[model samples]
Target: MSNLPKTMKALVAYGPGDYRLETEHPVPVCGPDDIIIKTEGCGVCVSDVKCYHGAGRYWGSETEKAWVEPPFIPGHEFLGFVAEIGENVKGFEIGDRITADQILPCGECRFCKSGRYWMCQPHKMFGYQNTNDGGMAEYVRYPKTAVISRVPKELPREKALLIEPYACSKHAVDRAGVTNEDILVIAGAGTLGLGMITYARMKNPAKLVVVDMIDERLEKAKDFGADIVINPSKEDAIAKIMELTDGYGCDIYIEATGHPSSVKQGLAMVRKLGTFVEFGVFAQETSVDWSVIGDGKELNVLGSHISPYCYPFVIEHMTDGSLKTDGLIKRTFPIEKWEEAFEYASGKYGDFKVAITFD
Candidate 1:
């Protein structure tokens, strides 16, 4: 009904060190097939840390590197209201609430056609190392394909903020092939690990053990329904996992911590033929015990990049009250205070998922 302003506030990353609260940014321009969203909430993901702190070097992709551009906005996990929908856009209207998938694939790519859009030859990521400015601002511009789903009216913005990360955890669980009979072990009780624990509980696993070095996170894991919580700092985690599995080892292991040692240990804690799904991003050149993996242990190693077809399922479960977003969300910050938000999310403030809210 009125003309929008040209400049807007954003949390901009100049190069790589940290984020700054910037107010002099042009609102993103949209193409005929694109939509502009007025950001409502943006979750601070660990990948934001990797991108800004150079921990994403392991990805080895020029697109990613280019996407994580200097002097850019940074927040992929977010929900927003459709501010303006370009002509030709269908099924969505201005003022509609929605969240983004973050990782967009070229539908024409062979990998995408094969249903492995995460591995698309020309992959496009949001608020990462190489795509476009993210939602840590007043507005975010996106293509129609990037929109995952509309937010439920019953879901709080804070709870809706968990959608992206939840989608990721869902993908990891799906890859692990979690079943009621499987003994699920999640490495790292961080946000992703915690979500994995919570979502894993929905599958009614026979046993669920979450491992973390920090007591607070372990407690959070417990709150999320982990049957057993292990503190590696005080005890042997691998042995504890083995004991929990009755010396048989866990049937499925999900690695949500980026530490290489944890990855190697996750591999070790799996049953002889168990599946190991990696949900964390390890730094460049991080080595693993491939020898054991290649020793014909029948190990299945899966690398999940966000979620391809898991969004709808996550939304359904969340809408049906199967996946709980409470407790997992720590706090919220106004978009103007994005620096403080990023700092809090980077573990400087505390262990929690710090989200930036527009309103």
Candidate 2:
């Protein structure tokens, strides 16, 4: 505490498409129920890309409410060491390695009371809302109510940063309710999609197909235990899936591609009464035929939001090498080169995950 600096570098998002690096941002003060963390690294997520592109979900459309209040930092997936702890903060000490759930639940909400804190009505996401600054800085304050966990000291930096996404992916796979007889298809081979592959593989389904536009990502999917990888750009994905399924269609279709077309494609490729799990966050509204979900196929549509109570499981799997993290983190940059980091994360170089590092 004696050597702590008064100010530190942070990246602040001023508006929909405006993000700036601030070198003199104030180091957050620990409240009675909060703790200050010295950020080690923060991963750039697809949600961050959507927020950067001024997606309606973050900026709001005519029918939606904007959730992001700018002038706030924009990182949620991160790991750090506790630099300072409040008097009332417990189970954590200075220099403890920690990471927090991005969604800060209001314990009083109906969802929270029902044990579904991930869907709490008044939740404040660490990076998007004004209540808490994100980890795209030297320090981030973890509110008392936030679900915090101590990361294993032996975990590699890249694997540690994957905890959040892996948790979310676990939620998605669990929601899919996969079985040995089921033929599953996961659309997209990005971060979340790759994580989905890791968890879905554990189910030992009859067939596990991965769809991606990039050949490199598809190849990585193979390394992650994907039975089949489809390059949508080079092949008619729906036709191929139909042929493989003998026109019966796949039993489970998980959409992890943020592209709107993937939704329609999933609808077209899923068998009747099959489960369709939508896990991606789209940048805009996507309209599809309603009958396909009701009268036509009677598909079971499930929505996976964020990691709820699956963090511990994800951490265990990551620690045990069940979830491979070797090729996941493609690049890392100092917090000062946030613009460059964002650019690389934006898919200009077909990178998987990009992280901003401190020191």
Tell me, by lDDT, which candidate is best: 2
- Expressed as tens digits, the lDDT of each residue in 167-244 for candidate 2 is 899899999999999999999888888999988899999999999989999999999989999997899999999999
Where is the poorest 10-residue window by lDDT in model 2? 1-10
Off by over 4 Å in 2: 1-3
Which candidate gets the maximum TM-score versus the true structure? 2
lDDT of each: 0.78, 0.89
lDDT of 1 by residue, 1-359 (tens): 32567889887777667667778788887778888888888888877766667554523365444444466678889878888877878888888888868776778888878877777786667775334778888988887557468777677776788888888888888888888999888988877777788788988999899888888888878888999888888999889888777897889888888888888888778989889888887665478768777785778888877876777777777878778667767678887666676678887655578888876
List the pairs of residues colliding in candidate 2. Answer: none
* Candidate 1, number of clashes: 5
The TM-scores of all predictions, comma-separated, are: 0.91, 0.96
Cα RMSD for candidates in order: 2.6, 1.5
- Looking at model 2, residue 68 earns an lDDT score of 87
